[model samples]
Target: MALGHRARAVIGSIAAAAALGALLTGCSTSSDEPAEAAEQAVEVDPALRAMLPGELLAESTRITVGTESGYPPFEYTNEAGRIVGFEIDLFDAASDRLGLKYTFHDMLFDSLLGELYASNVDVIAAAMSDTAERQADYDFVDYYNDSDAIMVPAGNPEGIKNLKDLCGRTVAVLTGSTQEEALAGLNAAECQDKPVEVVQFDTDADALAHVQEGKADAELTQWSTGAYNAKQVGSGDIFEVANTEIINPTPLGFVFLKGDVELVRAYQAAVQSIIDDGTYAEILKKHDLSAGAIEKATINNQPQG
Candidate 1:
């Protein structure tokens, strides 16, 4: 399963859902309003204020980052129980560039944002897609552009070559992911008058396992996740990448609390500096993920719907 293929399979069904309710949401209210309204609305404690951006990185020597640590080559714990991956490296590089100390906390991918809102962490360096809907809840620093792909058993035994081919086949996806959103629409249409089932898992590994066990016909996921799984499975011939599509090619970036403009600026500067100095490319290559890197962009302050 090539990275592109797995992303396609997972995204195919997800695109169907978007077609049902896919409308771009905006994030701007007024330029004069404080950018921290969302965090203030949540009433984060005073003690946590120091942890927010612009208060001085020295005040808190260690910053905490949250990630799922299950999506390999992006964020995953190694045999030593230390989180390591492309996102992890990016954070490490940023921390080093900023002379800031940090720690990594592994949690559910969907829960990472909630933890940030709760003031549990200072940043989220997971491979989070920067969508307008997500921007409404958090600030993002765009760093990469990722597209969806599909993954199937080698030779695509079911001839599951594309989303249209999945009309009567089972598909696996991670629960709570945008990929699931795509699948919802496909399932409604493709399985509307049939027995097709869309199975969901907490992680890509679990979803891929279901496919390996013959419990499902294929798994859909991010390009990187699909590629990593294919490599781990150790048989390019055993799995096939099919129908690559940019169904959800979103800017991937590090997430921060809504009002942390200073921290976001610092991260943006660090990311840009890395990109300029060639350090960013080195990190991506180190992880065999050079193709995923993208140019740095100003933080999009508008809300996403």
Candidate 2:
């Protein structure tokens, strides 16, 4: 919770973003174009491919994935409207180990689960964490280790540095994120006398906008994402990550439907293969996220038990 590792990751991210933004200034791409995962020379693992369901293989095993690209450094649309991030890189590695093809569909984070339930997609690889509550409807292929964080305007203007400082202040959060649930709980239990105002939005973009516009005092999101947005907006001029203990350090994974045991097994083995071969590590380092890399591939990762 000290954020010793995550904070470093954020700083590295800002340096990279600043460089990228400079070169792409004045250029634009149609937002309608979805960013595809990076195509790399990943050798296919025949053994893992055989573990996949026969029905899945029948269609050439091109897995359809749902994601919320509004979150940066992990999964977000770049200046070219191309989907690029560590999550995409991880999936690219997993697909290689599994010898499969994958596609990404960007949508509201709240609707990702629904799309999976409706059979519109085969997986959700949006840096989603595997929680006990989520386990009721989904299984997961754990890929990254991360935590929650808060973002406030630069220069410590409001002096909201820690969890306690959030009391009586308005904090914007994504509508269905763990941060929203966690912050509300904090309000009810710890800030009863002066509860924090929890403003909800369906998109990370909207939640971030609320804080930048001065309508909210702060925004709660994934630590790396908060850090990414801070440097991304104005090259470190817009916001700064609060100096608080990392909030909910947890595993972020590829969410799968509960009944797809075969598909789940395929991914678990594929993920382990990448971890063993160093492909996973390389991607993490490329995105300045090596600090959150997990040493093992796990399924349905819930730290509680």
Candidate 3:
């Protein structure tokens, strides 16, 4: 469905309202409940907590985390060249709780996975969606839930509203992302007879740039990514994100070497502790991102490959 200008404004207002409400509520559970009840609220496997550090270091130590610091609101280097965002802060909270230290290495989003697989970095916190295929290569600590969306220049000059609308148009997507997979499926199903051109970029910003310059008809990226990008570069009016169903909803998580059960458990415990408290929600709110928070089911489900 084509969203009218008024409709887009309303969606923007709703997104802002939800973000503010989440910030005000934070992550605090019901206060009337006993501490024991809150503690028992989420049953984290004891095996995960068993991986705690033997002795907390007096001085700060460092754990290397790989991320493409260009994907703002997720992980990105600000104007000062400092890496900051939801994922960075989440990991900082995790490190603080674990009494460990960390440093972030920014690289191409796609390369972060390879760096983890090669043991080049201890972990990856790059807003990476955890999928069965990816789980086969690395362990994950589920955190954010995300879906795909389409970004078109303001006014949607081309009248693009959804995937089906792009029957013969060119679409830009980041390499090595679920968006790519989804676009491939869409093309195969709807445009196979007259394939839609898919242009892959090394970074999401690059892909969005393609749309901005009219090189691409639409840019398919994570919903949050598109929202943040449009807000930042499109002045909240330069680009419009289409709420179309594309890929299956997936949870974004941190990736570590496969079989590192010990580390995964430790991270999981840290994440749970943050969630049980209010730190996790606070971080999300700070970034205007709360819809991305993991739901109850996602937290309980065991990681599967």
Candidate that scores best on lDDT:
2
Q: Mind giving the per-residue lDDT tens digits that candidate 2 earns over 195-253?
A: 99999998788998999999999998988888778887887798998866878887888
Using Cα atoms with residue i matched to residue i, what is each candidate's TM-score against the true structure? 0.76, 0.84, 0.78
Native-referenced Cα lDDT, model 3 = 0.68
Write candidate 3's Cα lDDT for 137-214 as tens digits: 777888888877789988888877777787789899999898888888888899887777899998888898898889
Q: List where candidate 2 sits over 4 angstroms from the true fold.
A: 1-40, 59-61, 302-305
Better of 2 and 3 by TM-score: 2
Cα displacement (angstroms), candidate 2, residue 123, comes to 0.7
146 in model 3: Cα distance from truth in Å? 1.0
Q: What range of 10 consecutive residues in model 2 has the weakest lDDT sum?
A: 1-10
Candidate 3, 36: how far from true, in Å? 31
Residue pairs with colliding backbones in model 2 are 35-83
* Residue 228 accuracy (lDDT) in model 2: 76
How well is each residue in 71-92 modelled by candidate 1, as lDDT tens digits? 8888776665556677777766
